[model samples]
Target: MWFERPPGVPDWSEAESYLRRADPALGAVIDRVGPCTLAPRRDYFVVLCKAIFTQQISTAVATTLFGRFRDLFPNRRPTPARVIEVLGRADPAVLRGCGLSRQKTSYLADLAQHLADGRIPTRRLAGMDDEAVIEALVGVRGIGRWTAEMFLIFTLNRPDVFPVGDLGVVDGLRDVFNLPARPTPAEALALGERWRPYRSIATWYLWRRGSVPVAAPAVPVPDAVAGAPPCARRRRPRPAAAPGAAISPARPRAQK
Candidate 1:
């Protein structure tokens, strides 16, 4: 009778037991991965803005850019109003100096306006369901289904979201399930349904599966998976198929 609970919900032991009963395949992953204790971000605006900067880039580059973007505010949290003001006064090149492309700058500007004007209702998102948040956020120029879904998982802490477009998630599912090939977006969604009501928690474990330990020395990445979004498929090689050892090499893609 155990089932996976949302972020604010307690009784993880019961939820884990429920998930084990619901899908033994995922249960195996749970056993291997151990518990999920992901901390959700409270700042929706900053997260979405950072998602734009992270698209199609390496993590080091994203880190650098994110730091620079934050420095524009200099010890502040970079609210939407301040972002819009800075964007208005600063040169496009100035914003680009933070590693944003011209397109992303435009997207960021649009996103700031939406939040500033109450179009996105960023403050009210906590009360909305996943789909409602997605619909509301996607109306902004740069935000898409994938970005909205990430916001749900990382920002809102919604437990049921399944970001099938994410290369890491797709590859993680393939390796965990021992599929013949990587699943298409549709197929990934279908497979993720089995982890219902706590797919976000499941996703954290999947990412962990493919993730190299923080202290592990860097290893050469293998060739990218075909059809994966640019810069999102470079993965550390998995050791020859052993149970609990199959890791996806795919990186997180910042889908626009």
Candidate 2:
């Protein structure tokens, strides 16, 4: 279940109204998707870790690997101490076997050390503004602007964040606006200005629009024993032909 919006959160509708008054294109999209609220997620550490895991990977694969990592330490989410405890003595190959790249493993370990040494407190970031949060997060190795922006949107649930560097957002703009070519990140930032404070919600919708739904796995049938009769396979029925393709009862059938 999703967490409810905290009390006194800014009204998205009002933001939408402001954007609509600013640009017709943004207003049109807002009209279509309607009001959107921030989708709350787990705390900073988990979100950052997951984001690191998901870098340059498909969502399905990332989800599977993240699940496996969680199973390794049941009930407790990955914390700084837990990361150090599990990874300090564990072989690098073992972490790599969990689908983490060597660079990511090193980066995560560095992050854990920073957290453990009181260099950065996860809780202290909450009260800071977006820029400040980004500044602090990117101070750690391997954490970039895109990762920090994700932390802002997913973990902090900040009202305004537009990751102009995101490829999906750029593609979304091209597809939605019917542009001949994809815009550069700079161009995307300029275009995103129209969305303003509700850019986070707009970005969420853009991602949702471009994401392909994952198909469920197919169930396997049991193999037949040595003496057992083979089970019949079931097939889906085809749809009936339309009027033009239908055969008339009055017409004589042609022999094959």
Candidate 3:
């Protein structure tokens, strides 16, 4: 059962109709998965920070690290100014202590700097088209095309993004379409042509195919290193992937 509109998200019935009409292979997935249920998040920097932190880490680990990270902020939430201030006081080692890698630490610092300097104005994103938004976001350190695509889908709720580089998406397509081998990014893009204008809906279904459900990050992470937000709670352990399942690696390539 699909809603005409799901709270903050745009109506998805059009996208649903298009995807089913465009490809029977995807139609099967829709039949199994039902409807798109993406909800937008308001905190641009937090979500981007989470995306960077999540690079190459399991969701469980990422959840833990994010909890530790939000502790550094005054309210368990990070704004550009506060992030910059915290980074200044806490050296690289301190950040790494929160489960961040050297590269990710540098990436966060760079992002904070960009946001503070207004080089990557989060407010301007609403007026820009998808490719322009990607261009803007990718200019930041450690943020790639795949990351940009994710922002478009999860943050802005753009409908047509197809993250061809995502392993989950690739594996989903491979299994769903019965391809002889995992399709290359180019092949994935070609295969996705039919789902145009609503590819994001299709992507939502693909991700669901082999994913473990976790509570949304909207619940702030708990156990602050410095008396951060009290709203954070530890996420429960998730079951491991089944044998021969498609493994989602950290940071999909930003190409094709």
**Top candidate when judged by lDDT against the true structure:** 3
lDDT accuracy of residue 232 in candidate 1: 28
TM-score winner: 3
- The list of candidate 3 runs beyond 4 A from truth reads 1-9, 91-93, 210-250, 253-256
Instruction: Please provide TM-scores, in order, for all candidate models, with all chains considered together.
Output: 0.76, 0.70, 0.78
Query: Which regions of candidate 1 deviate over 4 angstroms?
Result: 1-11, 211-256
Span of ten consecutive residues with least summed lDDT in model 1? 213-222
Give the per-residue lDDT digits (tens) of candidate 2, residues 1-256: 1234456654566666776676554455455444555556646677777766776666678788887776667485788888878877777677776787877787788788877786667668778889988887787777877778877886677868987667667655554444445666655665566667778866765664422211111222123311222211322322322322311111112111
* Ranking of predictions according to lDDT: 3, 1, 2
lDDT of 2: 0.62
- Backbone clashes, candidate 2: 0
Count of clashing residue pairs in every prediction: 2, 0, 2
